[model samples]
Target: MTDFDIPSFLKTLSQRAGVYRMFDADNHLLYVGKARNLKNRVSSYFRARGLNAKTVALVSAIHHIEVTITGSEVEALLLEQTLIKEHRPPFNILLKDDKSYPWLHLSDHEFPLLAYRRGRRGGTGGKFFGPYPNSGAVREALNQLQRLFLLRSCEDSYFQHRSRPCLQYEIRRCSAPCVGLVSREAYQRDIQHTEMFLNGQSQQLITVLQDEMLDASSRLEFERAGELRDRIETLRLVQEKQRVYGTDRNMDIWALVEFQGVTCIHRLVFRDGRLLNSKNYYPDNLAGEEDPLLLLGYISQFYLAGHAAEGLPAEIIADIDSDEMTIVLDALRQQFDRSILHSRGVRGEPRQWRAMAEENARVGAQTRISGHQESLRKLERVSQLLGLDKAPRRIECFDISHAGGEATYASCVVYSEQGIASQRYRRFRIRDVAAGDDYAALEQAVERHLIRMQEASDLPDLLLIDGGQGQVGRIQQVLERLSITTVHLWGISKGETRKTGWEFLWAAGARQPIIPDAHDDGFRLLQLVRDEAHRFAISGHRKERSRSRGQSDLENLKGIGPKRRRALLLHFGSLKNMRGAPREEFAKVPGVSQKLADQIFAQLHGEDRSV
Candidate 1:
């Protein structure tokens, strides 16, 4: 490989608006950015005196630079964001959790259920009500609406399997839609009211509820009348509390704060004059750019990348102001093709909202810094306890999950000095392994994980096994076979009671276990990591199992598609009901041919007969 010829390359550089990419010696992208003047922007990195430490580091690693010219600066800006999201270079401001925004889905069915979803990947029909900021916000909104409307929230699979209502109906959160207690018409009425609430027609809904309550009372249905009256009163109380926020606007408030290099941005979301949900975003700014441009880049990337749940609310209140911001606003206006009204200047409630955002960001940063310090101290103690040369910066724990030897999954959870790096967590489906053979499953998972990390050249400092000396031995064998010596491996085994805080730690070739006190911070951290691995594995396994179970019974039969299965199930009510039925009955269902019906009958009912 040859070093980057900066002087020679700069000779032919153009001065047009475009996006530029910087690559290191291995042809790995190091950073990507947009430039109004490509020549000037690219040359600034090579300048001798003005670059910061991070920029200088980036420039030093550069082996090549690539530029893509665009028609205009706006196109260049959009292209820059797209590349950043796709490549995620080290020097760029990376947004963690770049997954699609969460939404509240109302299904279209006999008794529709309200569900929180992150993406539109499910094979079901539904109406989406949000691109909410985060999962927590979506769940909170769904829970609140379910409480008011008593609509079902269970998955269709669970609903289908339920012989009776589960705990949710007993708790009055669901009106037993899975069972026959709730009529389709009644559920539709509840859905309509829920839609009104989501659509910001709260007062109209209250009026409708009041009228229903009076009608029920006139009909001498006191129980029904009382329920409607309570709903009306609760909605009225909510309206009273929401009166402070005028019913004329929906907006998102952005506040950015930097504390000792730790930057936190707090976003407050409001809709229909009511506070909906808020979230704190902590971006990784490795290049260390600090200016109003930081806030601008964040907002631009958020909406342009489709991270904003509601996609540019009617109004946006940001904490920073600058002439440079107009560049982004105009780009946004051109991209979204709307009058993007923006202002840093605020009065009254909006000013308070911005202030609150700032305060939240400040507090969030302080807490994070404090928490990081405490984590370091805990790591220091762990270093001393383990007699290691230094504290481990990145630790990973592995676990295995299965139920009766089916759908086995091995999970690896990562914890860094900063905190739990959940985005780096991974799950591996264990295949071709014997039933309940956790030892082999774990060994296989560790082998795969180590090989990948080796190729990526990003091995963890410490490896934790969620088992005793036996698991540690298997993993050690994997490392020895792979010749990986830098990673420190240890095992944690549950006590005889198999409870938390009773864990025995085992190191490689160690005869005795190190059983630390429950209050030890390092030990507590291990417990947390182990628990997270267990949780991740179990959740992934359960989802896979549920998905497999949801497949049609006729899926394995010949000549049966989704439509055929639907028709068969609908006509027979269920596969069980068709057990003793003749092939002629199956052939009568739509989309079922006589020959195929005979085949299905033979496979499903162990009998074959001509239709």
Candidate 2:
């Protein structure tokens, strides 16, 4: 079994209830389970003896684990079920449920019924929600519906035959439409709301419920308003169940996501109307971009060559919805010699499956795109995109920070293959430039840095500036005068909204910017470095600004001694007041002479004069 720092992880684990997810080396979610006491449950996995084959196999594949704390055991159970449905990990399938997952079935009748229906879902339903993790979850949902909607759960035959209000009606669990105690219109309104919630228009239904609640409160119907408020809360809990299920058995969904110049295609396998397995495939030599044709080619090779571990499904749904899928669909039919259903522009429940598949792809991509290996890989891709001989080992980004126009400072953040060369990171105190001039400030900082590089014979492979063409141009002129040509330059320009992953990238001497895909790894690397430089620069700027404001200018003046400077400050109250005072006001200080007053006056007012 792969070694896990179980002791260390358990030390940090809380005794609270929550869900823990196990993952393999590839970051594929291995298993998800809920616990009453998270620490005890997770600890039992590493008991060191008397484990079953399934447990041993699962543990062997486990590389790491993550946890999410919830309010209570019941909450953890619901969350566990949701996550299981969302990811459908392989190890979870090993522990089988005694029966098929339960669904909250609402019957089609004049007085509709909301009840739990297990086993087959479609053949005998009016409206169906869930395949909830357990029977308890379904029951809870049904109870909530009975409380809020007051719909009947009695069999149609009994409902039709009722002559008087039943126990359910007396207790406010049902509207008693069978007894004609409630109007058909009023009964139908409740049905409409239930339907709206099942259809995932929860916000729309909540709005109507709240508005009605407000109206009831305005009319002094406190009881009705209170009931409405309870309904809203119940609605939130029940609606947590995703409506992504369908009756389609043995289906496959392929979601391809390209992040940070890497392409990952995730395949979700559905067998016997259950999510059997979810896996991500990083096709070799994708070279950091997603092409529709390449995606189609991958799909062709994946299924046609019998690479599908679960075999060809009854239907294949892809993240793409372009006309190019037509060719692939036709090819799949010819290859398999059967009428296999292929769709991209899906609607209803299958649409949710498509969305779920894509979301899983993204999650998988994020896991694959993080950590030291991915960083090194990204640096290589960046070098390739920038047309460099090898991956740039040392990269730096520069940013300028100031308080409107004062206390200007510049930061140079360093990034190496091992990640953040913090020891090499440097911040410059920008001086001798006009207060508000950012261009001049940046120029001065870069010039000084380049001079240091020249002196030490050490230069960064790539230099990144957190500005548009103007800042890049300013830096270019500095490099030109210094005759430095070994370094590459990039400028990042943010949009007015300043959203991440959408910055316009400018390469020096290029006519147009290199605007790669929004989630491109190369672009993300630049954003990380730029953001780091901004952080360091702003922190330094704040400290420098505060330190400057705290000190008196008289301390830096050569001619003024401590005692005389103190007397002048005491008389004037502040440097601002003293700067405005004339030579006569300076001599008014008890310790100052007339001659020394002229010198003090000239220095205080920044006016050069012969003393």
For model 2, residues 1-611, the per-residue Cα lDDT tens digits are 35555544554454556678899988888999989778789888888898899998988898987765443454466556656766678888733443456777778777777878875655785877765656876687688778778989898878878889899988999888987888999988988888888765666666677678779989999998877766665565455533223354788888777655556677767776645555667777546334565667788888778888777888888755557767777787888875667777366456656655564555445445544566688789778766678889778889999978888999999877655666678999987889889999999998999899988999989999999888998899989999999998888989757877678878887667776666666677777688879878976787787688895566645567787775554455457555544334456466777667767765553332410
Candidate 2 — number of clashing residue pairs? Answer: 5
TM values, all candidates: 0.36, 0.52
* Segments in model 1 whose C-alpha atoms lie over 4 Å from true places: 1-372, 551-611
The lDDT of each candidate is 0.71, 0.72
Clashes of each: 1, 5
**Clash pairs detected, candidate 1:** 131-309
Q: Candidate 1 on 1-611: residue-level lDDT in tens?
A: 24554554553354555667888888788888888777689988888798899887888788877665443354455456546666688888754245565667888777888888877766768787755434765676677678888998887788888888899999999999777888889889999988777665675655566667668888999998876655544343222211214345788888888753468888866666544444567898877677466888898888877787656777778856757667777877888886566667366446546755664566455445435555577567667766688999888999999888888899999877666666689999999999999999999898999999999999998899999988898898998999999999999899889877788999997888998887666786777678878878876777667676785445655688888876665454455555534334566566786567657865663221211
Worst 10 residues of 2 by lDDT: 602-611
The predictions' CA RMSDs to the true structure, in order, are 22.9, 20.4
Candidate 2 at residue 196, lDDT? 81
lDDT of 2: 0.72
Candidate 2, superposed: residue stretches over 4 Å from native: 1-102, 105-129, 133-140, 149-208, 216-230, 236-243, 247-250, 286-290, 319-327, 346-355, 377-465, 468-524, 531-611
